[model samples]
Target: MGSSVDAVVAPRGVVDLRGEAGAEFVAAYPADAVVVVSGLPGAGKSTLLRRWSGAARVRTVDPRTVHEACEAVMPAALPYAVYRPWARLEHFRLLRSSVRRGGPLLVHDCGSRAWMRRWLAREAARRGRELHLVLLDVGAATALDGQRARGRHAKARVFARHRRGLERLLAAFTRHVRSGGPLPTPEASSVLLLDAVSRSRARSVEFGAENATR
Candidate 1:
């Protein structure tokens, strides 16, 4: 049943950022757009944001940065669990502050958290702005490799949960596209999917005319 629905709603215009052509697509992206960079924990979202950090109109917020800051104040041997709640509090506090400021923003997200997406969508709506998603479609093995390379590892169970949730989100996105139905969320204007290879070759994320007014 679900498979049939997915077939009907498969995305038709998903851009593949694989080569020189992909650079053109990135160039056309709208500036002043509110975008979420979502993927597994280690899928290079922070790296991508760093690449765009120099843009005058772009402001980025990543929870991991908060987590790292919290870690610095504690014992080197202490586990993250001890201060996890404080990290979460600080992260959301910053997000809320960003939303209030109302400018072009980029946020890092692990694709599993539906509530966070919904919250972002609501904030966008309230601000009369549209939210966009840049989802990295790297496989679990590659994502795990990324985690190891970064020297940060999510628990096995947590990683499994993230995989399941991301799969469901991708499926929903595909189905919505194939069906030509209303957008998954009125506040969300588009979703862009990229693979690991494509992500590596991409140079910049440019904002187009759509961002001119904002």
Candidate 2:
């Protein structure tokens, strides 16, 4: 069973990655930071990383691409349950490898998994690196629409769980920010909140000299 976690609080800083300014901000984001891009299954985490993967010193691990490849060859009627365990195993194996060989890493996250976030935080801390979050705040309807557009969808029960977990996380962050309380996770140095529009506008994820000092 998953370990129980306390409510997540706001981070040290929150930035909206929208417009030219947002793009520029991403370009100047710290090179050494470990950024986790999190959202519901179709909230464009993969899309954003695909655009920015070519940047120097930035490496990304997206499990969806691998899963998609496997799906192409597998029978359409085969239940995902059969291969999901293997896919998860491969994803974490790659994630661990990336963390071990890290310079700058971007991870795709399904917002429902608190254990994954905790593991990432511990890994970053162990390596003396900072972990950050880039959370997508898209509505459930928008996310479901995206799933259809991508021709991939999570089971209804799974999607419902994701929606609830993400909503709670967002709400907790909001409350902490409003109250000016301690951050939710000290392991995470900062969090960036982006909507669909803002995510689209961010063209490149760059790391500059200025960020290295932070």
Best by TM-score: 2
TM-score for each predicted model, relative to the true structure: 0.79, 0.81
Give the runs in model 1 whose Cα sits over 4 Å from its true position: 1-24, 27-31, 55-57, 211-214
In terms of lDDT, model 2 sits at: 0.72
lDDT of 1 by residue, 1-214 (tens): 2221111111223433323222212323444457888888777887877775564348899897899899999999988898899899999999878877876788998867878888988887787766787788787898899999989898999889999988887776667656766555444566767778766644555554432111
**Considering summed lDDT, which 10 consecutive residues are worst modelled in model 2?**
1-10
lDDT of every predicted structure (CA atoms): 0.69, 0.72
Candidate maximizing lDDT:
2
Candidate 2 — which residues are off by over 4 angstroms?
1-12, 16-27, 68-78, 211-214
Superposition error at 127 for model 1 (Å): 2.0
Per-residue error for 101 in candidate 1, Å, reads 1.2
Q: Write candidate 2's Cα lDDT for 90-198 as tens digits.
A: 7888888788785888888885677888898888778777788888888888899999999989899999999899988888777776786766555577887778776
